[model samples]
Target: MATDRLGLYVHIPYCVRKCNYCDFCSLPNGGAQVPEAYVDRIIDEILSYSGRVSTPVDTVYFGGGTPSLLSSTQMARIVYTIRKSLNISPHSEWTLEVNPGTLTKEKVDAFFNLGFNRVSLGLQSIHENEMKTLGRIHTFDEFISSYNMLRDAGFGNISVDLMYGIPHQTLASFKKTLDTVISLSPEHISVYGLIVEEGTPFYQWRESLPLPTLDEECDMYELAGRQLAVAGYEHYEISNYARDSYRSRHNSLYWRFGEYIGVGAAAHSFFAGQRYFNTDNVDDYIASSGISVTQTPESECDLEYEYAMLGLRLKEGISLSDYESLFGHSFIDGKEQIISRLEEAGLLTLDGDRLALTEHGFYLSNSILVEIL
Candidate 1:
């Protein structure tokens, strides 16, 4: 199943209002009113890949600006088209990314009915002030309501997104957020450290903002790992936690360097040994029927390096024997000294044939990776 399976990502570039800290491709005013023509373009793109993709799609992710903003009818049409045009497996994990205020009970039921078995809710923090600082449109109560609606609709798999290193966010406040989210007991959790990207409003106001210090941010990250582990969640990836088999299959595919096709504006894809992305402009994507902005075939060296880089993100790390089979050389062929040095530093570990980062090494992964690679 792992050999030839594919993942599908549908990007909905519509949001009620862009967050101050976000630099992702999205239109602030488009969520409230997604044009039918845009939806049709997505459908057409899916159809275009019908006969080309030989593998069965095992995972489908509807990521967004806010995918929950689509009307029930529009969502249904897209789902219908995917099933009709693609070799989607019956047991595929279909995930929809939603914002609190964007969901309703009817929409929740419709999502489940349309085969979206997993939902990733974006609720960065519960504190009203912190929410405002992040430019979120929903209140804490609204998020609770949305979660309740999803559960009431019989949706068992849910993932909540949390953020740290926020402006004026204290350790105590972040601890409370973790406590509150833990109490809800979602199937999966993702904790991300806020990055003030260059084009975002946060970047413009960076000098005046009271962001948590680097030490405090590190503390928050450590606290999350400790608390989540105690709460019976596995730190499966650098920023993701899951209970049992609840890990995000869609995301896991990417970390494995598996093939996937992305549809819609600004979506990226890796298939046929090539990597490409659609234009960010919605109108341009619609007119071109999802023409790629750029398409480049990846070299064997690129894939080997990519495999090593992405595999390192997982807690299980990369399999040296498997790497040899794929690349016709040992991953540690010429880097024995560097690997030994890192192992001595206790930053990395070689257990049997699998090479992985130690618990402490995860914190310094970027630097460790730079040194090794």
Candidate 2:
């Protein structure tokens, strides 16, 4: 097995109902039902990469339009196929994204038995009205029930998804959601502000919605960070907070610029200084002769800018040593003026050997990063 770490991401592009705010490549639950034949095609794709990428995989994440929709037998088959075909590490953190409406006791046990140690539940909000407004099938009670079931099913390393900045979301409502989440005390929490994508229904009606102001959104983010921190969760990455030893190792790989292979429809991967993505259409993905790797158009300058933008999202920020090792040059020499300006504005901090963003900086992080890049 190679010493270099790798990650495997499997995208299941099926959802019961398309959320208004979502634009990820996913089909309506009933429109494109996931058949066993589809699963076999994905397994074939996984096998194709066995000899191509020789590194040992440290993480395997089943992200989706609800990976929980798959039956235990189906999930076990996928996990088993990967284990047989790849050099999967014994202690790899295998995670599956589950929706509140889809989880069951049997499915949870099967996932645990098949070596899925981490579960990310899509409990977007604990408010029933908000859930309905967001077109979520699961009610608040159902989410709580699913959560309790996961706990009862012996899952300790769990992460819950929460959304802020909805159409009518007030600070008080957001705070209540945060308080409810804190009380549950999952090992990890991913708090995301709503982003209305171009093709989504939310975007069509965005102008009519009473969206939170930019400042209010920032306040909500900072407040959530402070509250989660107070509850013993470390605000490790942007939108991610975790208790000690429970950070999302798989996602951290993306921000840290580690290599990973993405399998299934619309999945993206970065490896060997190159980035590529599979075709987004499910039919196209299943019909393709084999694994298709489309090389992305990116320049060295583009990569550098991306590195800084992504790395800065972490609370620990970017390290000079790692930056130099990867790029074969010193960050200080090329970006002195830009860094100085950001630091002077109090948006960034330059410690001994690391550069990190301030809490205030995170709100305007994208703009600040663009300026620096």
CA lDDT, every model vs. true structure: 0.91, 0.86
- Kindly report which residue pairs in candidate 1 clash with one another: none
> Scored by Cα lDDT, where does model 2 land?
0.86
Residues 178-237 of candidate 1: C-alpha lDDT, one tens digit per residue: 999999999999999999999999999999999999999999999999999999999988
Go through the candidates in order and give the clash count of each: 0, 0
Q: Pick the candidate with the highest lDDT.
A: 1
Q: Estimated TM-score per prediction?
A: 0.97, 0.96
Residue runs of model 2 more than 4 Å from their true location after superposition:
1-3, 31-33
Regions of model 1 farther than 4 Å from truth: 290-293
Candidate 2 Cα RMSD after full superposition onto the native fold (Å): 1.9
lDDT of 2 by residue, 1-373 (tens): 1129999999998888898888998888753346777688889899888777778899999998878888888898899889988899879999989888787788888888899889998877777777777888888888889889888888889999998888778789999999998898899999998888899988898889778898888889989988998899998887899998999999998888788989999999887768899999898888875677688999887787778788999998999887787788887787788888889988899998899988778878878876776
Q: Top model by TM-score, which number?
A: 1
TM-score of 1: 0.97
